[model samples]
Target: MNMLHLPRIGITPDINDLPVPETEYVVRQNYADAISKAGGLPFLLPYHEPVGDYLDVIDGLLVTGGLFDIDPALYRQTSRKDYAMKPARTNFERALIEGALSRAIPVVGICNGMQLLAVCLGGELVQDISTEIDGALEHKPDQSASIAHHRIEISGTSRHLQTSAGEVHEVNSVHHQSVLPSDAYQVLAVSPDGVVEALEKKDGGFAVGVQWHPEYGVADIDTIIFETFLSKAREYSQKK
Candidate 1:
């Protein structure tokens, strides 16, 4: 692809739930700005239409972060009252993710987006990290961008380690639920407390999910994550 032919990257939006008279579909500017800076045409994909339709147009899919959690029922677990969820958003996102994966399009999931990736792939979740895991570090960090909440050891054998350029790197943490150990996806990296911090498909598609929000520009490795995804997306677009 040429410089003028940037891939159209479809970004999933977060449903704003402020209990007002109106509902809004919001995509964080940072997400779009990052994709644009990385050489991809960022488009905000609303939840109004079937995701399959959008799959035929966009070259890549980016699942964004949200304040709500995913319903456990999607993974065959009983729903929890304490857990807050946006069924409409999850339903739409699940469709988009499944469609994108089936088409072999590059997909990147961040924060809750990562959890949705795990659940949609026949895997389970930690649900609540602090209460479920022993000695779990402070996965939830404040709004400060400079804070390095935790460190994740990139698995030497995992493809995602190539983005890190090293064995271990510090990241800004801002999530509670995480992927439980599973075979559906290869655990690419993990927090010191054993929480799954990063993952990629076991069968080797251009699908990757990170527990941290790379759009916020926290660590140096964040650039690699977006650059790699956009590069893969560009190649996919050229093949088409």
Candidate 2:
């Protein structure tokens, strides 16, 4: 795909609902760099009350990792450990993800973004990894991915996984919560510990969610993920 022919990319942004004179709601440059490199216009959307209004303004969506967690109540349980559950953000994230999926929009969800996708699809999450999985990969939210964690086996036939070959990727880890298996979604990849690493909607759609942060890697989202997404967005754009 030509860089000039890329479609607009919708990058979901974090919002602040509190009454404050100053707030920092920004999208990092890495996300844009990846999208631009892959040929896509960058569009960042905040937690607007009526999120649907902006659904048609972009060709694809990337749910970036953030400081908040999905409200456990989304899965029919009260908050455990009182995790930094952002109810409003969680609601918006799910709505946007579902909105995009309904239209067959090429979508990619990072750490928290993947969690949002899971809960939105009626799946549960292990809120605290330290408590559940001993010796779990370290997920430092504020720290940089300066170290290689572990390799993930990419299941064949998965576009996202096949992008990197049969080789296990030496990617960074920086998340505690993980997606629990769901009947509606297939586990595309997993950590050596048997944790759900990535998933795809078996119902049919260009969607995938991985627990790792692709944005922080050497080449964000890899060429295949971005190429596939860009190609889909291009096809969708030309049809319109």
Candidate 3:
């Protein structure tokens, strides 16, 4: 593909606390590799106040998973347990998501990123599925990211069905918090235990969020998801 044809994908990095005074902004290597493999230019976005500045340059927004939780207060819920959170990162991501959606930019969120997206769209999170839902399967499995932990049944009405070869897809789960999408969003997939696994915008625009790390390329569906997002992004870039 021509360099100009490759859509610019702005990816949010994980904020990590270093022993020193400065904080580190980093993304997993596979996240960038996946975007590149999908024929999109991956750009790590730093935490900044002006979301428009970033939105103005990127054709797509990729919200990556992190080792923290979003402030439950953002979803009109109180914290049930103490957990680490980067308020600055959360604030920046919230603004970036809102700006991207307002401008109709393609977005794909993973794990905690998905949770934040749900919150941004007036949805809520399960907080901790194990505690909140009775008999919920273990969402955070103790295994490699490349291994499948569970299978999700894709909804027949979901846009995901277009790329999926079958209604059931084996996915690697790594999130304790799952999305409870708002009325504006449609639940695209769910686990056998009844936990939501994926969601997309009701209007059918590419604003998909998955509670698994698709960048790990755990399954064929993972690549399809990235391809679908990049395809939409390429379209958005061409119009620009």
| Top candidate when judged by lDDT against the true structure | 3
Worst 10 residues of 3 by lDDT: 156-165
143-169: candidate 2 lDDT, tens digit per residue: 566455766766534743455335466
Q: Give each prediction's root-mean-square deviation over alpha carbons.
A: 2.1, 2.8, 2.0
TM-score for each of the candidates: 0.93, 0.88, 0.94
Candidate 1 vs candidate 2, lDDT winner: 1
Which ten contiguous residues of candidate 1 have the minimum total lDDT?
156-165
**Per-residue lDDT of candidate 1, residues 1-240 (tens digit):** 465699999999987767755878788789999999999999999786767789988999999987778888888787555888888899998999898888899999998999899887888988888888999888886656457777888763556335542477778988878898788888888888999988888765688888988998887778989998999889888888
Note the Cα lDDT for every prediction shown. 0.84, 0.74, 0.86
Choose the strongest candidate by TM-score.
Answer: 3
- Candidate 2 similarity to native, TM-score: 0.88
Scored by lDDT, model 2 comes in at 0.74
Error of 2 at 195 (Å): 1.8
**What is residue 125's positional error in candidate 2, in angstroms?**
0.6
Candidate 3 lDDT, 1-240, residue by residue in tens? 454778999999977788546878888899999999999999999888688999998999999999899998999999998988889889999999989999999999899888888888889989889898899999998898899989988763666436543478888988888887569588888888888888887664578888988999987779888998999999888878
